[model samples]
Target chain A: MTYTEQLNAFYKMVSDECVQGVSLDCVIFGFHDTRLKVLLLRWKGTHEWCLPGGFIYKTESVDVAAERVLRERTGLDQLFLQQFHLFGDAVRYNREDTWQRQKMPMPFESRGWPERTLSIGYYAVVDQTKVMPTADFMTDECRWWEVSDLPSLLYDHRHIVEVALQTLRLQLSWQPIGLNLMPEKFTIPELQRLYEAVLGRSLDARNFHKKIMGLHILTRLDERRTGKAHKSPYLYQFDRENYKKALISGNLSFV
Target chain B: MTYTEQLNAFYKMVSDECVQGVSLDCVIFGFHDTRLKVLLLRWKGTHEWCLPGGFIYKTESVDVAAERVLRERTGLDQLFLQQFHLFGDAVRYNREDTWQRQKMPMPFESRGWPERTLSIGYYAVVDQTKVMPTADFMTDECRWWEVSDLPSLLYDHRHIVEVALQTLRLQLSWQPIGLNLMPEKFTIPELQRLYEAVLGRSLDARNFHKKIMGLHILTRLDERRTGKAHKSPYLYQFDRENYKKALISGNLSFV
Candidate 1:
């Protein structure tokens, strides 16, 4: 579509029905190759990247809006999505120079949106291999970037990512929610590596192993046979029933 | 002041300069006599009690607005305040019969307020003895109510209080922030009771004592003396330096 057509389509989509002054930005987290990553989108006609976000419709609840945004971006449904924080800094969208630097029109301002906006930040854990991200009409590209080495994001997105990571790290301490980012079966070393990536530091392997075993949320599985490896560690799968019980009772502690 | 004069004053206070479609409801928590309580206000011309709340001004950040509201109601400043949740149900303010039943004017609608509003829930911990809650123009009275036995609240204030308590319970598992609700010198049993009040369940005394001792975030003080009591338990004060460090590093675990 032409630039005008895309802009007009975007305007038409949002102008009539969305709740004014409110938006939902999602930090979809995925674990792959021993690194934690977040999904970002590059706006059309600009190199500026931002979290996949959209305004809430007047007829829908905020939670439903978040789910809709996630489904539209990842083509996945019923994932563990959590509302973590709300960013309401008055200057969150005041960087007009950013638009000028990127050589893109200020769609929100030009189209007469609310002067001040409050965005609800949500974080989701999904299996990276299961997602096939497709750009929407207003986005030129959609891709995953390592959370540790993210680009210069638009607006307060960098801060949003930091808060999301902090929330994820806190949640990791008490709940076994990170299993959504892992495969159906995984080795102890792989699980430890994912925890290390999310916590942004290396943990003592022996202590981590002892803690995980004490929690008793993971079931031991048959050893994986990587032919080239000297010896394969035992694989494990998260015991779904026990995990849910632990989450509800606040018993799972891995930190 | 007369009812009409108070109502007019409240209308003038909120009509001209507040942000549209956004409000802040504060769940100010206090602990006294081994019970957790929340500050609530009876609205003018209505027996319905609600969390002491106000609107955010266009010129101030939401955080500042929360502090302002708390200070206005309690005459306390620099307390431990946290933004826990945003209540944004489409029907949050759709209960007109609630107003009509109380014979109170629908000031918000009569003054041309937005049809829908999103409220940010903030929880503040303060020493109950230090607070001197004064009624504002819109409030007929302001008082603290035990969380265990609260009266019918306005809007979704009940849900807001529940979320605040849940957040407090979650924070108790990781941080020593509940100290604000405790006296300067407290026994281990007193501390345990505070935790139980926040968690809404009785905890094992020996286990809780051992866990708290292992944390080493409390400085043992001299034993308290009571003429009619049995053996006195040792008193303790939170070691401020270590408490701050634990909060920053996320190491303080009490559960």
Candidate 2:
């Protein structure tokens, strides 16, 4: 469908039910094969791509809108989503310029598009294996893009992604990771690789092991993975009680 | 002036120039006399208090709006302000109920006030001694209240302040503090007191001193504070270069 046609389909709800001048964009982060990936969607009838975002209904909270947006795209509800930042520059998106670039008609303020829309940016960590990517009405393609290599995103989306990643990286100091990205039973090296991908740098194996162990938020299982050429590493899972405690206390001392 | 009269004077500018359904609330935290204080304002002709907040102008970014709001209330510009959260529940402020409770006439949607508004919450660390509080057109009084003992705040402001302070406390894990809250020359014990005030708990003086020294973010001047009966303690100021580096790197290892 053309951009106008697609927008016309939901224009009423968008104008009346949703709050004007306020929307939400989510940076959905997924980890797989030791590579950090972000979910992006290709705009329908266009080559441009952007983060999976949606508008907030007058009845829904910003967080609820974020979760609804994420669920609509990922086919998963109740992921570990967090509101990281708000992108509210007056020139974040020039409507005329953006429409010209997209080769779409400019509906202007008459179509409920505010001159300056403030976006609440939320970041979520999910296991890539579980997400069944689905496209929304405005997008034709929904897939993961490697964080290190991304398409030239539309408007201020590139900056938004950078801020989201930076927020996630800094959050590692206070919040425990690998809970959503890792398997229930995984080895230390696998966990370290996840951390390395998220941090965008390698850590000393010894130091990483010591730090993760010191937190005591993980439980070493009696079982071990077999079929490796080398010595089988012991499998471990998050100590749910301790992990929840550390999260609530916000004192997880891992870098 | 009454609430209606106060809002009427700015209604034209607010309706025409400001972004609808979006506002900014500042949790301005100040440390004084071993207490953490928050700057609040009393609504005109009402006993209710709330965080000093303002709406974003159509031409201004949210950060700029926050800075503008902070400057208007504190009479100080360029504070160490940080956006921490967005409070956007539909029930955050029930306009009709709020007006009835405040014993004011409900202007409803006719005024600039929307049924639902999303607030960008920013937390600022400032030296209380440097602030000269000023009331705005909508408020009659502006001053500091010890966080431990606060009046019933309007709308969701009490919750907003809690979230801001929690964010500030968690931020101490990675971000250096006291630069904006402390005097130019302060002793180690004085710095410790500042941290204690923010964290809402006492710290071991020896341990705090050791940790702070290890961070190398402070420069011990060749001077001592000599106003007490006890031995004078050496005065120190933040090492500008190191402090900036720590802030940018977000790797400060103090809590």
Candidate 1 clashes between residue pairs 3 or more apart in a chain or in different chains: none
lDDT, candidate 1, at B215? 73
Candidate 1: fraction of native contacts reproduced: 0.32
Query: Residue A219, candidate 2: how far off, in angstroms?
Result: 4.9
Task: Give the proportion of true interface contacts each model preserves, from 0 to 1.
Answer: 0.32, 0.74
lDDT scores of the candidates, listed in order = 0.83, 0.85
lDDT of 2 by residue, B1-255 (tens): 765776676776788889987878999999888888999999777888888998898889888999999998888886799888888886886666677656555565777566788889999999889999999877789999998899978878999999998889878866887899887888999889888888888999889988899888999999999978999999999998998888888777655
Candidate 2, residues A154-252, lDDT tens digits: the string is: 778889999999988878856887788776788999889889998999999999889898888889999999997999999999998888888888776
Q: Rate residue A54 of model 2 by lDDT.
A: 88
User: Lowest-scoring 10 consecutive residues by lDDT in candidate 1 chain A?
Assistant: A101-110
Clashing pairs in 2: none
lDDT tens string, model 1, B60-101?
Answer: 778889999999999989889999988877777546766764
